[model samples]
Target: MSSRQRGNFNYKLAFKLFSSFFFLSAIMDVLAEANGIFALNLLKTLGKDNSKNVFFSPMSMSCALAMVYMGAKGNTAAQMAQVLSFNKSGGGGDIHQGFQSLLTEVNKTGTQYLLRMANRLFGEKSCDFLSSFRDSCQKFYQAEMEELDFISAVEKSRKHINTWVAEKTEGKIAELLSPGSVDPLTRLVLVNAVYFKGNWNEQFDKENTEERLFKVSKNEEKPVQMMFKQSTFKKTYIGEIFTQILVLPYVGKELNMIIMLPDETTDLRTVEKELTYEKFVEWTRLDMMDEEEVEVSLPRFKLEESYDMESVLCSLGMTDAFELGKADFSGMSQTDLSLSKVVHKSFVEVNEEGTEAAAATAAIMMMRCARFFPRFCADHPFLFFIQHSKTNGILFCGRFSSP
Candidate 1:
């Protein structure tokens, strides 16, 4: 197949694998509307052309990381030019070719970041999708490194990812990714594409942002400039653990974020681990955060992060694509060879206007909430979980967001 065809095939393979681990049945109670919407949004942001079901673009990647589908254009041709200017901190993008050459170079250059792609390919399922995309990919990744400190192969991957992100968001997003994750000895680079865009969903009317007494946990309350918004929203419920959910949308109606809190006390820190699509659905039903006259106050902040997937992917059970001695990467090298390496990273940010959310969630919401007997107020630190329902795994299980 042609290079673009190969890239497309690889992306599909990876996505399908990503889907299996995530939500294989969108309508079978396996995926939530948020995940479905996010999936569609991702395709729309990347390139959704019905004609070219399998075409390569700046918005597609062969494989890597937590199987998080940050973004992709189904069939439309990717706009390579637009990626140069988007300065939006919450998004990222990339594109690359010559899978074999790149992997070889990364292995030679990234000498200090080995052990990054730990388990490699344990519960891999993208084997088929990648083949359809005409690309070969597997998970073997870890967190990203700081810029200015990137090794050659890592820098190259960053270049491609940023290129796509900048072009896609019209420079609204910047290059916030690096590669110092694995050892240089096994730093194998591969062809791939990835992007993340987290803008403000509610967009705390910056003009209306006010300093409110932000209750942390039991006895901690700090005056924080909280962003406030009033709107009819989608809801979810967590059982007795304590909390209700609010699904807010952004400008395009393609992306969103889920916020959860306890019923009586917003002890966010204690319940971060229990937040998920299933739990949210359960919590929203049992607990109601949207009480009558329920005015919501949130924060306004943005975190643009990029990390290597080598380690995390392995941790999630994907281990076969990185073994140079036992790998089967002839598709990339055109020769009998062991799998070299695969590096994948992404960028994401959560802001006030809305959330330009990207890939992955790490269950870590730590806060406390204070509420009265019958009122449902999420005004405290409660578990904040971000899930990709597709994989049923939390892409972002943290405890923070702004108005």
Candidate 2:
């Protein structure tokens, strides 16, 4: 319950947090355009039918353009919702460059994740998807570099990015970034926000999981299966949410895979929806329970996914942000400018006790599928997810039935 409220609160918080970073004009234009491109890519990946998922909030595959361009030159995040127009860059940086760079990065990281995951899990499917996205993403990034202003461009990108990510993620990830979230001692704080989630092709067994009473909320208790497992892991019990979060560290401790199991009567999906970066971080710092009784369910599932946002933006009428001829970036440099790319990457895998996921955003083009009825006899509801402890990002979201 608290997590949900917090998630709702973060929506406004995201707007306020990065609002001050850049001038209104700069932030609005760049972020809006980038978000559109992001949406377009989704059409490319999942197809037009899935538009509702990428367009709306909560369960939406969406993003905001936010970043701080820091080059030897000065930078700025303009105020105002609509983007300001700039002189055509004979070759100078363009409005789209920042978003292009952002998308490019998103696509690059997403591809890397898909490839690595395919090699380990998906195999041939990974190769298939990679082949499809490679050309598109590269072309997008190449386009962004056509006009580049290192510093100002970064500022325009970063300003709204933090806010965009914070809003999309529901604050599960306060800072959608790593060491750079709080850039050194510099007065300027540049944050990159990332929110991603996916469901399994298979789900865990609800019947197989032991159903027992759980301490759901501060005021309630109900029957719930506390998924159990004996594994070397990290976990935290959140008093606010009345749940215990278990962290299953991935290959490189840098990416932490986690699970949120509510006290009895608590809804896993409810808890999942309410997750935030602030709350997630708090969960991680918790003291570990080396050995304890837990109710666990194993789900048989897998998820295949990817996205692009160019067309979505075009639909929004931010044409100038994507093209060199149409884009505007004159404010940054005295010369011409054009967007290179705006990229984003996301991945998640889920099982009974928890999940594993990773996400990144760049300005290059970035980029997913699904279905199955199993013959297994496992009957019951199971829980699973992949969460980024640092940013509270849900890579994949799902529930399993073992009936």
In candidate 1 the C-alpha lDDT for residue 109 amounts to 36
List ranges where model 2 is wrong by over 4 Å: 1-229, 268-274, 286-295, 306-328, 331-403
Q: Clashes in each model (backbone N, CA, C under 3 Å)?
A: 123, 126
Q: Candidate 1: where is the Cα deviation over 4 Å?
A: 1-204, 213-223, 234-239, 251-255, 263-270, 281-292, 329-398, 401-403
lDDT by residue (tens digit), candidate 1, 1-403: 9999999999999999987634323222222333322332222232222211111111123223212221122111112112211112112322112222223333343232111111122111212223322322331222221122123354555565455545544454445334443332422334233333444443445666777775554556767666665444666555656566676544444334566666644444335434343444555442355533234676544433333434433442334444444444433333333223443333344445443231111011111243332223445554344433223322333334222
Question: Given candidate 1, what's the lDDT at residue 227?
Answer: 66
For candidate 2, what is the TM-score? 0.34
Candidate 1 residue 402 Cα shift, in angstroms, is 11
Superposed Cα deviation of residue 19, candidate 2 (Å):
29
lDDT tens per residue, model 2, 1-403: 5998989899878877676434333533444333333332332333333112221211123222321121112122221022222121111243434435434433345321221110000111111222322333234333111111223344444434444545544454333333332221122221222333333212233334576543333454455443333222455567776676655554433344455556555544455445543444455553544433222343333332223334554554445544544444333333333333333333333445222332221101122112231111112222344433333333333333221
Q: Alpha carbon lDDT of residue 143, candidate 2?
A: 16
